[model samples]
Target: MKKSIEEIQKEIISEFSDLTDWEEKFQYLIELGEELPAYPEEKRTESYLVPGCQSRVWVCPSLENGELQFYADSDTALTKGLIAILIRVFSGHSPKEIANASLEFIDAIGLSKFLSISRRNGLSSMVNMLQNFAKNSGSEI
Candidate 1:
């Protein structure tokens, strides 16, 4: 069975809790970025780029069999990992769930405290972009 968002969040929190410092978290994020699949050059166009982000961000959300899926990429490595993190949390969720998700869960995971201000802003923008896509696609989120 597919994992629920709560389960995924718990798993992520457990995984990250091993590190005691922000630098280690940053390094872990970078490592996660290294594992992200590269976005095709053809897909890296103005249409996909998310506004309000410091780095070039491309987000695509689609519905398959009533489930939401997200494809995202970013020019910055750390940002890409951020996208990956979002994907882990939001993908396969209902639009309403994604839209209603509180940042508190992220904070609970300790990611918010460790991130730089710019990175936090970027994360907010990324979430906005995903929510926008869901709204446009006729999902409640």
Candidate 2:
């Protein structure tokens, strides 16, 4: 009964469609980050730290039955929102599905263009981090 990854991406795209400018979209993204659940201080260990990002990001990825459960937080609001967006697509899906996800929706929504070069690199790093977790769990992306 759950939505597929494409469905989620399309929904996100639709949400962005209502905003006419990048500034508005950026604000919306910040709102999303603000709504993210509080991360426990205990889980902010080095093991959860994501490297290569200007802003510190901590992600705790686990599997429930066969689906991925991604718990993430970031020191920067924008980065937190970026992680939230990825979580919406990858969480609750099987590792193989996550591995195979296109994620071209990022471009479709013009997300990367609005970000700075370093942020884009950080975003890519976050994606790689998640995909690496999927691969480590035995999914072939």
Candidate 3:
């Protein structure tokens, strides 16, 4: 069976636990960004751009085999990693699962306290956009 979102969150938290320094954690996130699947240049149009982030972010959501799949990219590596975390949790999940997901893992990983206020707000915006997609998808399902 597939792991629950909570399990994924816990795993992330555990992974971050090994890196005590903020800089180490920061680098780890950037590494995670590097792991993101290459995003298509053709899809970077305004239609896919996520609003409310200081850095440009593009997200494409699609339904495949009854699961929601997300493809995303960001202008900045840090932001890309942030979105990567969200994608890791929500991708391959049903619309209901995505819509109901919580970002508590951010706190569990001690990330929320360290991010700049603007970054935090941007993260919230990212969540809102993805959740909007999930909610809309749920209605169609």
Candidate 4:
């Protein structure tokens, strides 16, 4: 069975808990970014661009077997890492699950505190976009 969003978040929090410093955490994020699947050039158009982000970010959502799968990428390494984290938690879940997700891991891991105000806003934008896609999809869980 697929893990719930909260379950996945807890696992991520546990993973971050091991890192002693922000530098180490940042390195971890870069490694996570490196794990993101290769994004298609065709999907990297204006339509997929996430608004309000400091860096260029694109996310494409597809519904398969009653779940929403997200494909995302960003121009900056840090931003790419951030998006990768979001995708790991949100993808392969029902729209209802995603729409209702609290995403407490962001705070629990001290990610928001480390990011710049602009980057924080960008993160917020990314979360909003994900939820909006879920809300708009009208798919049953």
Candidate 5:
């Protein structure tokens, strides 16, 4: 079975708790990136291209029986994992919940401390894309 968001959050926290430095965080992100599944070339078209990322990203979210599902791909492995993290946080949530989610969750998890300025910006852009999709689709969150 797929892990729940709470479980994933716990795992992330546990995994990163021992790391006291930014370099370790970068290494951790790269390690997480290794776990992401591959994104097909066809999915990397213009419509899915996320603006503000140094790498190409494609995020497709759909609602099934009132639950949101997300599929994402990125040219960069680390970015792909970042996409996965975003999906874990926002997928399956109502649009309103996603839109209302505090950035504090990221900070609480120590993600912001480890992320570079560019990576943080990229993450914000990704979140915006997810929120926009949710709004357009009329999901509750």
Candidate 6:
């Protein structure tokens, strides 16, 4: 069976547990960003750009078999990794799953406290966008 969102969050928290230093955590985030699939150039447009971010970020969602799949990219590596984390948690899940998720892992992983105010805002924006996509399931976002 596929992992639940909470399971994924636990895994992420576990992954971050070993990296006690902020520098290490930031490096890990960059590495996570490196793992993201290359985003399509054509989809890099104003409509897909996520607002409230210090760096330019774009997230595209598609509904397939009732699951929401997300593709994203960001101008900065850190932001890219942030999006990657969100994608990992939200993608490949039903709209209701993504919409109802509490995403407490962010706080558990200490990411919320470590991020700058702007970065935190950006992260919040990304979460809002993902939930918005879920809320507007099957409709164009």
Best by TM-score: 4
Query: Where does the lowest 10-residue lDDT sum fall in candidate 2?
Result: 132-141
RMSD of 3: 1.2
Please give the distance, in angstroms, between residue 1's alpha carbon in candidate 1 and its true position after superposition: 2.1
Poorly placed runs, candidate 3 (over 4 Å): 138-141
Q: What C-alpha lDDT, on a 0 to 100 scale, does residue 85 get in candidate 2?
A: 91
Clashes of 2: 0
Which scores better on lDDT, 4 or 5?
4
> Candidate 4: lDDT of 131?
90
Alpha-carbon lDDT of model 4: 0.94
Looking at model 1, the pairs that clash are 95-141
Evaluated with lDDT, which candidate comes out highest?
4
Instruction: Report lDDT (CA) for all predictions.
Output: 0.79, 0.89, 0.88, 0.94, 0.74, 0.93
Query: What is the Cα root-mean-square deviation between model 1 and the actual structure?
Result: 1.9
Candidate 2, superposed: residue stretches over 4 Å from native: 139-141
Lowest summed lDDT over 10 consecutive residues: which window, candidate 1?
A: 132-141
**After superposition, candidate 5 runs with Cα above 4 Å error:** 1-11, 139-141
Tell me, what's the RMSD of every candidate? 1.9, 1.4, 1.2, 1.0, 2.8, 2.0
Worst 10 residues of 4 by lDDT: 132-141
Q: 89, model 3: CA deviation in Å? A: 0.9
Query: What stretches of model 4 exceed 4 Å from their correct place?
Result: 139-141
Evaluated against the true structure, the overall lDDT of model 5 is 0.74
Order of quality (lDDT) = 4, 6, 2, 3, 1, 5
Cα lDDT tens digits, model 4, 49-76, are 9999989999999988889999999999
lDDT of 2 at 65: 89
Off by over 4 Å in 1: 139-141
Pairs clashing within candidate 6: none
lDDT of 1: 0.79
lDDT of 1 at 68: 80
TM-score of each: 0.87, 0.95, 0.95, 0.97, 0.78, 0.96
Q: How far does residue 117 in candidate 2 sit from its true spot (Å)?
A: 0.4
